[model samples]
Target: MSNRFKNLIVPVLAVVLGMLVGTIIMLVTGYDAGAAFSALFEGAFGDIYYTGETIRQVTPYILAGLAVGFAFKTGLFNIGVEGQLIVGWLASVWVGVAFDLPKIIHLPLAVLAAAAAGALWAFIPGFLKARFRVHEVIVTIMLNYVALHLSNYLIRTVLSEKSDRTPNIHDTASLKSPFLEGLTDYSRLHWGIVIALICVFIMWFILQKTTLGYELKAVGFNQHASEYAGMNVRKNIILSMVISGAFAGLAGAMEGLGTFGYAPVRGGFTGVGFDGIAVALLGGSAPIGIVLAALLFGSLKVGALNMPLEAGVPNELVDIIIALIVFFVGASYMIRIFIERLSKKKGVK
Candidate 1:
C-alpha cells in the first residue's frame, strides 16, 4: 500500500477500535450498547434541530482545533489556548455590549477585537520562550489559571448584568442566521460555522502556499538551521503563537456572539480548549482532518445527552468513549504497525 493509503487507514482503524472497546464497556455495565448508540445517532442527526445543534457545537471545536493544529505544525505546544479563548470571549463581549454600529461593521469589529485579545494573550508565552528561554508548556499552563481568574473578576465587577453574565449584545453585533432559523426551527447555529470554514481555508492556503509558513515550519523543525538560512527564528516563533491564539480567540467569539449573545460567568474553565487538543490529535493536525474530527466530537457531545434520557445510560459514558478515541488516536503508530504487518503477510501469500 502507498504511504498515503496507510496514513488514511490508521485513523479509520483507530476509530473502529475505539468504538469496539466502548461497546465492550457498555456491555460490561449491563446497558444495551446498541440502544445507546442508536440513541446517540438519533439525537445527533435524526432531525433538523439535532443536526443544527451538532453544527453549533462543532463551530468552536473547528477553531480550537485549528489553533492547536497550527501550533503543532510549527513544533509548538500551545497549552494556553484556554487562556487565549477566555481573553477573546471577554474582549468580544466587551465590544459587543458597548457598541451600536450597523450589523455589517459591528459584527466584524467584535470578531477582530476577539482575535486581537487572543493574540495578545498568546504573545506573553511566545515572548517568554523566544527571549527569556522559558518553557512554553509551563508558561501556558500557568496562564490558563490567570485568564480564568481575571475573566471571572471582570465579569463580576465590570461586565456583570442582573444575572451572572455580561450585558446582552446589540442585535447588530449578534451573528444570527435567519436562514438556519428557517431551516432548523431557530436553532442557535449561525454564521460562525461559515467563519470557521473560511479560517480553515485560509490556514490551509498559508501553510501550503506561503513563504511565511515555510519559514515557520523550518524554525519548528530546527531553529539553528532556520537561523543559518537567514530566517528570523525568533520572529517566526512569536508569530506562530500569535496566530494560534487568534484562532483560539475566534473559538470563544463563536460562543459569545453566535450562540450565547453574551459572556456568561464561567464558574470554571470551559473545556473547549482542552478538547481542542483531542480534536487536533484525531485530525492529525491537518486542516481537512481537523474539520472532520471536530464534527465527530461535536456529534458525540450532542448525542451523549440523549443516551442518559432515552437509554438509561450514564452521560459520563460518552466521555469515556471520547477518551478512548483520543487514546487510540495517540497510539496510532500501533495501528500503522499492524496494517504494515497485514500488508506484508498478504504480499507473501
Candidate 2:
C-alpha cells in the first residue's frame, strides 16, 4: 500500500477503535454508550453557539499542533511548548495592556510580542541542543515549571497588583468579533481562527516549496549527512525551533486576545501544548492532517461538556476516549503489520 493511503487509514482506524473501546467500557460499566455519544455529537454541533465554541477551541489546537509538527519535520521534540506558550501569553497581554496605539499597529505589535517571546523561550533549548548536545525534552520539561512560576510572579508583581489577572486588552488589540459573537449567541469566537488557517497554508507552503525547508528536512533525516552535504545543521536546528516556538506563541495569543482578553496567573498548565503532541502524532505531522486532528479533538472537548447534562455520563469519559485514541495511534505500527500480513495472505489465496 502507498504511504499516503497508510497515513490516511491509520488515523481513521484509530478513531474507530477508540470509539469502539469507549463503547465497550461504558457497556461494562452499565452506562448507555449510544445515548452518551448521541449527546456528544449534539453538544458539539447541535446549534450555532456550540459549533462556534468548538471552532474557537480548535483555533489554539491548530496552532499548537503546527508548533509541534513543524519541529517534528526538523527532528526536534519541542516539549517546552507549554513554557513558550505561557511566556507568549504574558508578552501579548503586556503589549496589549501597556500600549495605546492605533488598531493596525497595536494588534500586530501584541501578536508579534507573543511570537517573539515564544521564539526566545524556545531558542534556549535549541541553542543548548545544538551547542552541547543537550536533550531538548529534559530542558523543555524543566522550563515548563519555570514558566508557570515566572508568569505567576510577573502577573502578581508587574502586571497587576490588585488581582491575579491583568486588565483587559484594549479594543484595538483584541481579536474578538461582535459579528461572530452575535452569530453564535455570544460565544467567544474570534478572528484568531482566520490566523490559524493562514498558518496552516503557510506551513504547507514552506515545507513543500522552500529551500530552507529542504535543508531542515535533510538535517532531520540525518544530521551528519546533512552537515557533510554542506548544510548548516546547527543553524537549521535553531531556526526550526524558533519557528515552532513562534507558532506556539501564536497559540497563546489566540487564548489571550481572542478567548480571554487578559492574562491570568495560571495555577497549572493550560494543557493545550501537551495535547498538541498527541495531535501532531495522530495527524502524522502533516499540515492538513493536523487541522483535521485539531477539529476532532476540539469537537470531543466541547461535546464532553454535554455528557453530564444529556446522558448522565461524566465528561471525563471523553478524556479516556481521547487517551485510547492516542494509544491506538502510538500502536499504529502493529496495525500496519497486521494489514500487511492480511494483504499477503489474500494474495496467496
- Estimated TM-score for each candidate: 0.97, 0.99
Per-residue lDDT tens digits for candidate 1, residues 157-210, read 888744578888988888877998779877788989999999999899889999
**lDDT by residue for model 2 (10-107), tens:** 89999999999999999999889999999999999999999999999999999999999999988999998888888999999999999999999999
State which candidate has the highest TM-score. 2
Judge candidate 1 at residue 2 and give its lDDT: 95
Q: What are the lDDT figures for the candidates, one per model?
A: 0.91, 0.94
RMSD to the native, candidate 2? 0.8
C-alpha lDDT (0 to 100) for residue 256 of candidate 2 = 93
